[model samples]
Target: MLTNGLVVDLQQKNMKIALIGYGKMGRAIEDIATKVGHQVVLTIDDPDFDAETLKKADVAIEFTTPQSAVSNIKKCADAGIPIVVGTTAWYNDYNDACDYVLSKNSGLFTATNFSIGVNLFWRITEMAAKLINDYDEYDAFIDEVHHTQKLDAPSGTAITTAEKVLANFGRKNNWVHHENGIGSSTNELELSVRSFREENVPGTHTVSFKSDIDTIEITHTAHSRKGFASGALRAAEFMTGKSGIYTMKDLLNE
Candidate 1:
């Protein structure tokens, strides 16, 4: 299942999947899922889709917008279907959503980004953050690029990276996302996460620690959506016969 503590293709079962959002990410997941001999029993493209059909699926993969992620999670929970969520910007309600699923005796697996490289990138970034934290001479910030059509500004990957950074950065207690202007609640302890939108860019995230002497940067760039799609399906497979909340760390056996 893991190659030197990193995730790789290690499938043991073919599952009936319920695709909760038939958008780009959903289509991507379905294409790979079908090629791997998995069946897609149901798809929800509209808000009015039948929730009863969820019971037909062994696992549900949700890639909907932030506004719709919570309700979709609840429906899967009600159906007693294990769900893997790839949506971002809905984390404020994440605890409630996971609690509801757990109460229903269903499993929940969620990730901000499903690419294998991104998961590894977080670890590399953490190592850098921890080493840099011992000295206050360098300051760090995150820079991310995504497609223009992406709903969230700072990309969920950037936020996750910042969380890893904050865990060790002695001076930074929180992160600030820079949109048209600086996000509210600016403070000295806040690290900056700058976002850029371009055409046809899958995604790219860089963490830079800069000082007056030199700058250190680490980056992971995605060429396409295939990596995310494959990882999400593998996560679905991992959810089979499992209960409780899971993340990429758990899936990769980290």
Candidate 2:
């Protein structure tokens, strides 16, 4: 059923959602949310964003910069609202945030990349890295492209992808960001990641293993923002009545 530009889920009814960012991802979430039978009750983007509006939501989906994500999530948890956070680069404080959520008895779900395809790509990258772990002949690199307006270079998706590969590929000890060319260490095991920004491109991530004889690459290109928006809404639904901190892997496993 549909009502006033809202998608009404026949089985689960409607959920009140609070949007913490009004950027491209935030707008995408709003569109997808209404189409999936949920209502966006609050949107906070400005410097004077009202925290009280968050109380109107049963669950909140937050996508903001690392500088603000932790504090925004803390507010939502303090309000006793469950939240799904898609922000990245804030994992440095993730443990503290989780503790706060537990103390407040609020539910929290977070992802470096919330697009379902990207999550699957993480797993695939791990499997491929493990397969080539013993093959010292090949060197690995990560390259990603995004819109010019993106605030972060290399992106959170690229970082997560690099982390997965490093964890599985025994040869690689660490990753270094490189621009215009690969890193200098030909013999040492290192992963070089590069980022490119273009006009209006949603996202594209590539993992490549190269050797003198051959090359293997895996790429996941996001044609639109809808995939990410959909996943966040799904996370909000999953977290509606739950408690404790969780991750995208946990959500996917369940």
Candidate 3:
């Protein structure tokens, strides 16, 4: 344990974290890990990587694109390293990755958005949806904004919010981007999720529940990407001794 701003015992299962991507998010993870008494042993950024170098790491935190994230997880699994992945848009292969991890007895955790506040917001949003389900008085909509560099529209956070809303409300069978101009006429509750990309915006997700009488809106705006980075570090630390496929919900609930 860390005490008085010092890592007292270096020999006591010191976790060697490997960063799979060295972009802005990776740098922020390094900073937070250092502050939280973890050591970063390796950083891999090459397009063609070597699994042998990554074998020295006890855990790997990946925050790369969809195309590269799955392959990175595969490499880490082959190297016998537990992994916490924060990459989005590659969820089609998520089940396969989890299967491989389980087969190898290695831990794997993933989150769409790794902001602590966002995770908490998601919990509250779910509770609100359940409470408002029977009311039929409130209509819901979700909006998300991210940096211009973000490739995915609507964002994983927005998708998660829609899922939570759908769980409580029978009206929504699926979510469609508002840009598609799909009108809601089935009296089925419709959630219109819109996405925006601007300069340097880390992330912002707003859930608006409205009625003819009043409107209740909950918004989680990230001032920086540090929160995501910090949460990823916590996930990496949490995955060190575990063997399973987990999500931020598991972390928050625990």
Predict model 2's lDDT versus the native.
0.84
Best by lDDT: 1
Task: Tell me each candidate's TM-score.
Answer: 0.92, 0.91, 0.88
Clashing residue pairs found in predicted model 3: none
lDDT of 2 by residue, 36-95 (tens): 678898888865566677888999899988889889888888888999999887888999
Against the unseen true structure, what C-alpha lDDT does each candidate score?
0.88, 0.84, 0.81
120-235 per-residue lDDT for model 3 (tens digits): 88888988878877777778888888888887777888888889888876666777775322344344445688887778889999988889999888899988877788778777
Clashing residue pairs for model 1: none
Error of 1 at 95 (Å): 1.2
In model 3, the worst 10-residue window by lDDT is: 3-12
* Residue ranges of candidate 3 with Cα displaced over 4 Å: 1-13, 179-189
TM-score of 1: 0.92
Candidate 2: segments with Cα more than 4 A from true spot: 1-12, 179-187
User: Which 10 consecutive positions of candidate 2 have the poorest summed lDDT?
Assistant: 2-11
